[model samples]
Target chain A: MPGWLLTVWAAVVAMVVVFTFLTIMVMFSVWMERKVAGFIQHRVGPMRAGGFHGWAQSIADSIKLLFKEDLILIGADRKLFQIAPALVMATATAMFVVLPFAPGWQVADADLGVFLILALASVTTIGVIMAGWGSYNKWSVYGAMREAAQVASYEIPLALSLIPPILHYGTFSLATATEAQAGWGGMQWYVFSSAAPVAWLSFPLFFIAALAENKRAPFDLPEAESELVAGFHTEYTGIRFSFFFLEEYAAMFVMGAVGAALWFGGWNFPGIHLLEPGSALLQVLALFAFVAKAMALVFVMMWVRWTVPRLRIDQVMTLGYKYLTPLSMAVVLIAAFWEFGLHLIQD
Target chain B: MALPTPPREPARRHHYLGDILSTIHSTAKGMALTMRYLWRKPVTMDYPKEKPVIDQRYRGIHVLDQQLCIYCDLCAKACPVDCIEMDAVRHGKEIEWKAFTLDYQKCMFCELCVYPCPKDCFIQGTEYSMVSEDRNDFVHDLLTWKGLREEEPS
Candidate 1:
């Protein structure tokens, strides 16, 4: 195969694989979220959809959404309204291109992986704004505005918090970052690295900021159903609504992937060096490690979602600006000084 | 000749780091509680697959003991809404049971019918699942096999 053609083919294959994985993952996460919510509230949720505790509930929901009649309101900007969900879904899916699941498992493996992810994540804000503006509903516009402001402000802290790991690894490539953690038999995962305890601040900072970026609970002011009635997607129905749902769930996995790659050592496991990277067993184990770590983070996100009440919009902004942003900046400085001091000690 | 005023303290001294630490502690505590319950047995009983344990005094469906019931129309008369209908045919000395139906649409399950039955034939059984597509299915025949199976011995 020719060089460009091979690259194109690889890209196509990766896209297809990622899309399928994301679709299935979103479905599973939806079911898991319901079960988690049910358990938290002391109820058995979705019992009879497929069989044995509603295993097929999400699939059934997807099927229902597929067949549901599409409702476009008279006030809606038909073109932009139709495109908003697709835009959100596309941007969310595009983030996976730079996210490294394992050593050889990334889609694009871009040189500037971190920058690409941050950029793509922000693009979802545009989709959200379009949805709100296109809907022609006051509540939808309110939701969209909240989302725009939240994502825009939270992106700063989110980006700042992730930088420490990139600095530690001294590269923007997620694969390189993962590889960097492979030292010290994976004991040197960036979260625990550096003698400076303040480097640890980045973990929680990144998580909270990521949660806000993902528009998850506590920071979920955009879709505050009590206030805005389903937020920017209020006018959406049927398959279009499902697209937004897909994007949200898939974005969670993307957040988990980025977190795992930057801090938790991606697919690196202790004693993993004994087996060759080419070995099927090693690859499987590496993949398993990566997935388990990411899923654990996702579970924590779910846990936080249920534990905390939604913050008011002002509170959300206060958290992002007055707290997380400053805290994250301090953490970056601490990491830099720690690295500098460590080098001096060696000299 | 101005009056002396007390110095104002530094705006109540906000504990930024301390607040963050406490927030972490409380958030962890909340998450721990939810996590503990996540593994615990769910309070829900799968309704169709698993039946709930109903209390003995729960007033659900009505049961009638054909053998114990006499030709007394007392239960029918005692019904507040005349939902209970009963009839019997007499052949010489032995009485033949003809028809007995309870109109569940109006039956309040007050156990009023039970108190008036001299033979202690009327009872509120625990069979609460009374779903049906037919409107008249709510009118339960006390002489049917289902009704007889639900009969509790006095």
Candidate 2:
């Protein structure tokens, strides 16, 4: 086969894999969210759907949502309303392509992997805004505007916090960044790296900013269900609503995966360096390790969502600009100086 | 003594470091408490799968002992909602059974009809989960042997 054909073939295969992973992850996250919420609240959530604590509850819900009557509001911009969910879901799928699942498991190893993910991630807010404008509803407009501002504001801290790892690894490719961190078993993971002790702050900063970016609770003013009645998707029904729902979990997984790859050493478990290289078992272990780390980060997001009450919109803004942005910038600066001082000592 | 005045104004307080510290402390405490509860059993029952511990004295659907019941109308008269109704025929010394229906739609399950039964035959059972699509299902017949000859004195 020709190189272009091979590239096209590879791209198609990669998309299928990523899309499947994203769907399964979303289903699992949805079920996990209910279970976590139920446990925290001292109640059982979804006991009957496919039994066993309703592990298949999300599957049942997806089936229900798929068959739900698709409602398009009168006076709505039909074109934009229909396309917004597709846009959101598309961006999420695009972002997942850049994430390094294992050594060769990524859909695309773009040199600007993190940058591409970040850029694509922000485009979802546009889709959200379009959804808001398209719906022509007051509550949806509020949700859309909130999402626009929140994503815009949180993007600063989110990108800022990532600089420490980017600086340490000195690479934009997430696969390269992950490979650079695989040393000393897992001790050399940037969080515990002596080269940049301040990078520890960056992970927490990134996690919190990512929460706001994903519109998880404490930063979930966009879809404040009690106040906004499902927010930008208020006018949406059926598959379109589920598309938006799927996008939320997909975004969360991508953010968590990025966090894992950068700060937590993606696919690099304890004593992994001792394992025989270029073996099938090694690849499987690497995949498991990366997923485990990503899931842990996702778990923390769910945990925090249940733990903290939703922040007021103004409070969300204040935390993003005042606390997180400044804090992340400080971490980045301090990390740079630490590297500089280490270089001088070596000379 | 002078009447104590309730403060009219909300207290204004701002201690950034202390506030931040306390916020962290309180959030950590709350998360810890919830974490403990996560492992602990849920207070709520599964409901359908697990039947609740119903009290012995609790009034539920009426369970009438047909063998002990006399055809006296005292129980029906004591009902506040007038839900209870009974009829029987006198055949010499023995009574032939007839309709004895209780309209649960009007029956309050107040134990009023149960208490006024002369033979101590009628009482409330703990079963509460009676469901039916038909409205007439609420109107339950207390007698199992409606116009029966088996319990008749020979």
TM-score of each model, paired residue for residue: 0.91, 0.94
Query: Which 10-residue window in model 1 chain A sums to the lowest lDDT?
Result: A191-200
For every candidate, how close is chain A to the native chain A in TM-score? 0.96, 0.97
Q: Quote the chain B TM-score of every prediction.
A: 0.78, 0.86
How big is the RMSD of model 2?
A: 3.1
Tens digits of per-residue lDDT for model 1 on B1-154? 8988888777866699887888899988999999888878888787777888999899999888777777689988899999998877775645566688999889888888889788788888988988899879999998843222244446
Across B4-114, the per-residue lDDT of candidate 2 in tens digits comes to 998788776867557657877987887788778777777789989899999988899888877777788888899999999899987775667888899989988889887
Docking class of 2: medium
The prediction achieving the highest DockQ against the true structure is: 2
lDDT of 1 at B148: 27
Write the residue-wise lDDT of candidate 1 on A1-347 in tens digits: 89999989987898899899899989989998898888888887788988778999999999999999999989889999988999999998898888777778778779999898889888887898899899989999999889977876689999998888877778999999899888777667777666427556788999999899888998878788888889998888899999999998888888998898888889998888788877888888888898888888888899889889999888888888889889999988988887788789889
| lDDT scores in order | 0.85, 0.87
